[model samples]
Target: MDGFDAHQRQMETLCGRLELIADLLPDQADPTLCKFTSDGIVKTLSDAQAFEEKELFPALQALSLLETDMKEIFAQLREEHYEDLCFAEEVRDNLRAIIEGHPSQSANATGYMLRGFFEKLRRHMAYERYLVSALRTKKAPGTPDAS
Candidate 1:
């Protein structure tokens, strides 16, 4: 499968595990589990963002016809990437706290954090996928005319 599909699959799996962890936190389940799961989420997402910015963004920018729209979208995406990295780090720290026996938030609060992170992350991935699809169907400027 393509890189996007593979990244998405990994994300989905990690999210599912996080959802389960969120369901039983601060009072139930093994706290160490959160540490493991959060680490994977952080690493995988960080890698995905790095890959997209380094490789995908440059390629998309080369499509002159889409440059203006892509500039806006790419800017927004970079902002989101910053926000997401901060959020992921927070989640990892919180999970690490749980593992270290120094939990700060209640079960509900931790659960909310996990849900918020995953849901927002899913939305981010969806937007990227849409852009990739657009590349396939839309013609690029400065290229030989198809018609």
Candidate 2:
């Protein structure tokens, strides 16, 4: 698959995984499950971030697809990526805290953070879907009108 399709599929998987992790947060003290979930989160987000920065944004910019009206959307997407990275760090820290014998202290807080992150991520995915649709519908310059 192309980079965009791959990224979209990754995002969908991440969303489902995040929701699972969120639901398991309150009882996430089990070493095996905790390790599995946290590692998955870190790996998926890290890969997605790298792809977006190294491939997706540059490709779109080269195509001049992020011009005019799409500039703001593109900027917002970049900003959201930064926010996601921060959230991922917070999740890792919280998970570490739980694993290091602070489960009672971190469980609720972790749950809260995950819920907020998931909601924001869902919105971001919706925006990305809109952007993709916009890209597909956009015609090349000087092309004959479909209508």
Candidate 3:
């Protein structure tokens, strides 16, 4: 497949993983189930980061100087990536507390915080998908819309 097609597939896969985490968020808030859910989220984020750093980031860098629109899209995506990192850090902190056998109240509080983070992350993924779609369309100039 072409570069755009490959990128689109990668984005879709990443979004699918994010959706799984989003779906598990409520269950994860149970404190008892938090460890499994947190593990899943950490895995998902790590996979996403690997894909972005290895594939997407390089593509964005190469394309950025070729088009103003592409550069702006890349910038927005990079900013969103930073936000994702913050979310991941929060997740790590919550998981660390849970692993340390924090008080029940603390576990519940962390679960609630994790739920909020999941919601924000879900929205961020949707926005990133939209931006990626737009960038793909713009990058292809008259190519038939495949997204």
Candidate 4:
């Protein structure tokens, strides 16, 4: 599969994993699970941000199918990515605090944060599905031979 497709699959797996995390948080909060989530999400968000900004965004930008109207959507997506990364770090720190025995300030708050993050992430994936569909239906102005 292409890089975009691969990243989409990764995001799907992450949503599943995050659902599992959501089910366990504030109740089970196992140190291993906390550490697993804390470590995994940061890396996953970082990689996705890099790929979207570098490869995916540029590819779309270079295509004729994307219009000025869509520019704002793309710009919003970039900002969302930054926000998502920052939010992931906050969640990671919270989870790590639990792993360190400090505990979150509130169980309800932890649940709220997890739900908020996943909801935002799911919205992003939905937008990307539309964008990717548009990309797939069009031909990029290039050949296998660069020249």
Q: Please report the candidate that would top TM-score against the real structure.
A: 4
lDDT of 4 by residue, 1-147 (tens): 156667777777776666666777667766776687788888887787788887666666666566576577678888888899899899888878878888666877877787889788888888877766766666575611111
- What candidate 2 gets wrong by more than 4 Å, as runs, is 28-30, 58-69, 104-106, 139-147
User: What are the per-residue Cα lDDT tens digits for candidate 3 across 17-114?
Assistant: 43454455433534444455455655566566556656555544544534466656666766877777778667765665555566334544654665
lDDT of 1 at 31: 62
TM-score of each: 0.82, 0.71, 0.53, 0.85
Candidate 3 has what TM-score?
0.53
Question: Local distance difference test, per candidate?
Answer: 0.77, 0.65, 0.55, 0.74
Q: Which 10-residue span in candidate 3 carries the lowest summed lDDT?
A: 1-10
Off by over 4 Å in 1: 64-68, 139-147
lDDT: the better of candidates 1 and 3: 1
Pairs clashing within candidate 4: none
Rank candidates by lDDT, best first. Answer: 1, 4, 2, 3
Off by over 4 Å in 4: 143-147
Task: Rank candidates, TM-score, best first.
Answer: 4, 1, 2, 3
Better of 1 and 2 by lDDT: 1
